[model samples]
Target: MRAFAALLDALAFAPSPAVQVRLMADYLKRAPDFDRGWALAMLAGGFDTACVRPAALHALAAERVDAEFLRLSLDFVGDPVETAALIWPESGTEPCPPPLAEVAPALSSISRQAAPGLLARWFDRSDLPVRRALAQLAAGRRVPGVTPRLARTALAAAFSADLGAIEEAWHGQAPPYGHLFAWLEGRAPHPEAVAGFRPLMPVCPLDETALASLDPACCRVERQWSGMRVQLVAESGLHRLYSGSGDDVSRLFPEIVAAMEGLAGVFDGVLMAACGPDGPPYRPAPPEALARRLGRKTVPRRLVAEVPVFVRLFDMLFDGGEDIRPLPLRERRARLEARIANRTRLDLSPVLAFEAAEAQDAPLVLKPADAPYLPVGPPWRVRKAPPKTVRALLLAARPGGTGERGPDYSVALLRDGAPVAVGDAPCRLESVERDRLDRWVRAHVTGRYGPVRAVEPALVLEVAFETVRPAPRRKAGLALTRPEIVRILWDLPADAADSVDALNAPVSRPPTAGRASRSLPSGSR
Candidate 1:
């Protein structure tokens, strides 16, 4: 084991990947059973022993590798217990192979006698992915003999060793499914429950079977919305919005905060493109209209006026004094609807009926937990959405200092050549530093810019932009257009006195935005 640690340290400091591979291959050929297995796995990109041990077993079965070599490899791979279950080589649901489990107690005894530094060395030398797999085993299996020897503190410390490996693999973000699963299984810390949103075990695209198994009557289906998921927290008079990644979007959607001013309790929903006079809705807008607003952070006055935002307020997890998450979807909705007075910003999401056969293909519609509703035969459910459309804007364009084009022109959706909804096109510039100038051109320019040309509402704009001024900071930040038409409420144009009343009016978020949020499953993005 000491020799193995030295080998790993040397390899870790190696200047070249090729050199590391050579070192590992040499170890596999010469080291003891445990070391060889681990070394071979290191040489291979995937670290799980399930892969390497199986290959070894196959070679032995084919008589490609002799019993002598296999025994040596097994020794080098050594007892899993020696590595503190580092080798966690599983052979299905049955007990671990006799050779491995037979040595578990001996290995555990050795680990108990070893010093802290030695234990650390052992962990460091093991294949990281193998160690991760072993962690799973240690967490699941309750080995009475081994468990007692390794005091609670020592057991806890053993678990910590896997963190580095896990973090290295996940790059700061928690392991997507496995980490959460481990928490649910009581292998890790109890998951932190936030005030507004619960850490949902989201149905991964891979979990099509589980999704299909969903009780349609118990769940409601809706289009996976785009845009980032936002947890709107307005407690007392303080308002703050957090992205799924925990980024503060407090200033991004001031209108939403204002819209939610009177509403009690925290809420969760997608922050997406809204139209009409008000702001974004929790629900998806009409698909056709939202296509134009996708990926847009900044909405110009004309577009804002035409396609403003309104909260769809689809599902409610909490009310002023109640935690309704445990309640069925139908019950939650009924309570939520009863409390919600703003039809413009909050409304009930409709459900769709589908049979079990339809369940696999179509999404499950989530409902309140206590509802007596059942699918006609199989479980059917309700889902809600709004319509959407795409439109291209041709704002003024200009060439930049780097000789690259700066976007200026834009177009809007129009019924009779009058701007109904407006959106800008994707721009390519040196960097974000040049974005302010680009935004100015897009927002203020009167004529067509760059490659952009005016198109009817029938033609949608495929635009890409970041949040320039989604939320208001100052009086100038509130300005969107002239006195003719204002899009947002708090950020009304100073001169638009006549339109101020209309600008203050409420609107709905386009259905596309809702759909976008679902598709993206945003978290603080």
Candidate 2:
């Protein structure tokens, strides 16, 4: 428990990625096998055995400390677990906390009714740092800067193994990864034919400057669908669908798995909800429409029927048992077309002529005709333009954390002449601008909602965003994607900011179908 707490503290406080990696590697090298495995799982967000709720923790804290003071501490700290850890009265008992292995299983198997007493005893046996770590672990809160990729990278560095090979072998395996550790320590052979995730090939954004140098005939253009990027794997009699980040979501989309029953390959594609029922002339539903079907453990039959999904194959990574990722784009595309021929719930992403691509308004994905698939660094991407911007009024400001002097701003749009909170604008303001805005916000405070201050909606900001969509749950009945404050419109009046209708205009109508590319195989369409 002490060692794990130190690791969490080191990771949280370390600003440099190199230092963090070194710290994690050191911990991995010395910790017991089961403890390290569970630590790795927690760091990677793969641990899901939280038994205590935040409310229960708060209630426990209130019983020991003054309830009103606990509430005040919670508001100031902005985290309930942290508040509990800090305010917890030490019992001064000789600390004898259990090992991470025991704690992990106990938390997983313990009943909710018995959780508070057990947690209280653990708290009494722990110091401040260990108490905080235990609280965070029980609450399932991730430590800052610790990610799955970072954990894998640290493991690779610790074991002196190839990072890519480690990533490929790490997937589809659960916690206390005994076999993985044994292989790393040379006590066991490398796992083979393990039907695991392959690191996805990501793309660099294509700007007009780079596009101008490319010849149209040497490139292929495909409409960049606003849907989830996924890899469908069917190998060694195991079928799985992985989200781009490598989450095994095979359970969420069983229809997709059923479609690839007899297939044997790893295919890279977009998983999109059909605008209507599955058939030829398939149109992609808007991103918001597809979002409804995501993240659920089980899908109701009625919902599945309402939002049917299909994969549009863009490239083939593995053809049967052969690794074809080294093949050029043209060859892979050819193989993909031949492999999924006549298969339901699968279609080829039509290749478009340069002229045909330029005629469309939707975002375009451009790939080199001869480039090979290079996992983690592909020479292909969506053609990007400057994000659209709009003037929005500042509605509230949430106090920033740690060293930040300025508060985070929440901007809003006008609906029926009333300002409705839309989304929080990220802190991209220049230092001078931030200082000026901070001063103004401090002066114009109207009311308080915990750490957030309701400001006099007088300041206007130029908020740039990539997209907007219908979000019925938001107060404005809309949501913005990648919203960032470009600059403050100091002279502009708040009422001069854009309206809800103005932002809604673009996405109001259903998506229009693009002209099918002539290069697509006839059978694919």
Residue 427 in model 1: lDDT: 39
Model 1 per-residue lDDT tens digits across residues 130-238: 3433322222222211211122112123234332222222211221224433542368764433333232213233134454576656555554444456666555566
How does each model score on lDDT? Answer: 0.38, 0.80
Q: Which stretches of candidate 1 lie over 4 Å from their true place?
A: 1-201, 206-215, 278-307, 355-525
Residue pairs of candidate 2 with colliding backbone atoms: none
The total number of steric clashes, by the backbone 3 Å criterion, in model 1 comes to: 100
lDDT of 2: 0.80
Residues 295-382 of candidate 2 have per-residue lDDT tens digits of 6869998888888999888998999999998888999999888888888888888888899898775678898888888865566778
Work out the TM-score per prediction: 0.32, 0.84
Candidate 1 residue-wise lDDT at 240: 59
Worst 10 residues of 2 by lDDT: 509-518
lDDT of 1 at 468: 19
